[model samples]
Target: MRDSFEHVYQLLTCYFVKVRLVDPDFVFDIQTTSCKDKRFTWYFWCFGHPTKTYKLLRPVVMNDETFLKGRYRGSLLTAIAIDPSNHIFPLAFLMKDSKTTESWT
Candidate 1:
């Protein structure tokens, strides 16, 4: 399963690069401990609107995490902010092998 995910990972890398080029505020990062290791961690964030329009949004923000029970067990952290119009906007996302203070922070 990990081998099969290689292709998808490559596609996502390309997509992320393109998105960053198109939207300067689109930020993403992939981190690894060893250069030869296949295991890595990543996060995504968008500041395009957040930097400019955050003041227009309500002060209410929510965050949550969902655990995955698959081969590569992990958790996805997501944050959403409520806009003045009562719309929920995804503020950021993070993928970690486990939930911890280090990962969540």
Candidate 2:
């Protein structure tokens, strides 16, 4: 799966671009080593509503990480907040090769 990192990176950039196209407020970031290497990291988030909407929601957010049990092992990190309507509002998501304090920070 090492060779697929480039493909995954391309797909994720495309996905984020499409999301931003639909909702310009969405924000995303991509980080990687030098072009000579292919290790990559991605982070994306959307407020889902106006800035005022955030004040209505609780001022609490939760984060979690889980190891992926798939062909290419990795970790999925997610940030979630509870909206005023009591529905889950996913704020951010990240995928990384491993779970570590460095990555989480």
Candidate 3:
């Protein structure tokens, strides 16, 4: 687990690049501290297909967050919408070191 976390930046970069290659409209944002020892702060991503499909889904969007446990503690945030058929469709996701008003913003 520690080993995996150590390579998170590289893995994340590759994952984002691959996603973008498959989806030109894939949207993502990564933020890190500017301190001497840079650290991961938060990450947000939304797939291209979902953005396009949202127009055909219900107007209401639901979102929620959960606390993560284990070596790395954090919050996982997600937003989803219901389709015309009442199927849940994911819209976006976020992972942050902590959950706060500033993080939500």
Worst 10 residues of 2 by lDDT: 41-50
Q: lDDT per residue, candidate 1, 6-105, as tens digits?
A: 5665566677788888888787777655678756565465546566767777887799989867565777888889887778888887777666576656
Per-residue lDDT of model 2, residues 1-105, tens digit only: 234645765687787888888887877777775688756654555545547556776899899988876555678788888987889988778777666577667
Error of 1 at 77 (Å): 0.5
Top candidate when judged by lDDT against the true structure: 3
Models sorted by lDDT, best on top: 3, 2, 1
Please give each candidate's TM-score.
Answer: 0.77, 0.74, 0.82
Residue 44 of model 1 has an lDDT of 61
* lDDT agreement of model 1 with the native: 0.71
Runs in model 2 lying further than 4 Å from the true structure: 1-6, 47-53, 100-105
By the lDDT metric, which is better: model 1 or model 3?
Answer: 3
- Candidate 3 lDDT over 19-104, as tens digits, reads 99988989999888787877778888998766477789899999998998766688999999888888888899988987667666
**Residue pairs with clashing backbones, model 2:** none
Please count the clashing residue pairs in each candidate, in the order shown: 0, 0, 0
Indicate the TM-score of model 3: 0.82
Clash list (residue pairs), candidate 3: none
lDDT accuracy of residue 3 in candidate 2: 47
Predict model 2's lDDT versus the native: 0.71
